[model samples]
Target: MKAPTNRRRAIAKALTALLPLAPYADMEKIRAEAGRAHLHNLPPTIAVWLAIIAHIRHAHTDYEKLLADGYDRDSARFFVIEQTNIVLTRWRATRFLDADDESE
Candidate 1:
């Protein structure tokens, strides 16, 4: 419980630092969800970047649908990589993946 609280604080601090710099209108929701995700399984070590990636995966790509279709995690992510990167670029993310980039 205490560890989860620390993780949430870490995510909130990251969101506070990053949200003002980004142009997202729904950043508050993203930040909130990211914190929840961190508690579930999303790594808190790189919370901000993972939060952005989660946003793109859910919002801009068919990643969840692909997973539901029985595609493995890496495969689903692979299928959506380009679309994910496009949204990453739109968000001014510094780390856009090339098609040839190793996903795992």
Candidate 2:
């Protein structure tokens, strides 16, 4: 197969694996809507990762603001750093493991 095809396939597989079941609090209508949402506007895994990275980067300033408002800096800092690591690991795994597939 061509490089771009392989990359798309790899990224699709990763996205499928990461896709979570929509939460339903016993509401059939809501559940159905969620399913439709998943089908209609699903974004690429790379887009999701980029969003997460952007959120993490934005949180730094938000965290500082909260700290100035007298919130605990350590807790906020730890939470931000911890989530950052999680996203980074996924990004690395997707980039490295799928390198040959051109999915990175």
Per-model CA lDDT versus the true structure: 0.67, 0.40
Model 1's alpha-carbon lDDT is 0.67
Model 1 scores worst on lDDT over the 10 consecutive residues at 16-25
Leading candidate by TM-score: 1
lDDT of 2 by residue, 1-104 (tens): 22245444544454444433312231223222323323234444554444333344344235566567676855555445545555446434332122123221
Backbone clash count, each prediction separately: 0, 0
**Which regions in candidate 2 have their CA more than 4 angstroms from the true location?**
1-43, 60-83, 86-104
Q: What is the C-alpha RMSD of each candidate to the true structure, in Å?
A: 4.1, 11.9
Global fold similarity of model 1 (TM-score):
0.61
- Candidate 1 stretches with Cα past 4 Å from truth are 1-23, 37-45, 98-104
Q: TM-score for all predictions?
A: 0.61, 0.24
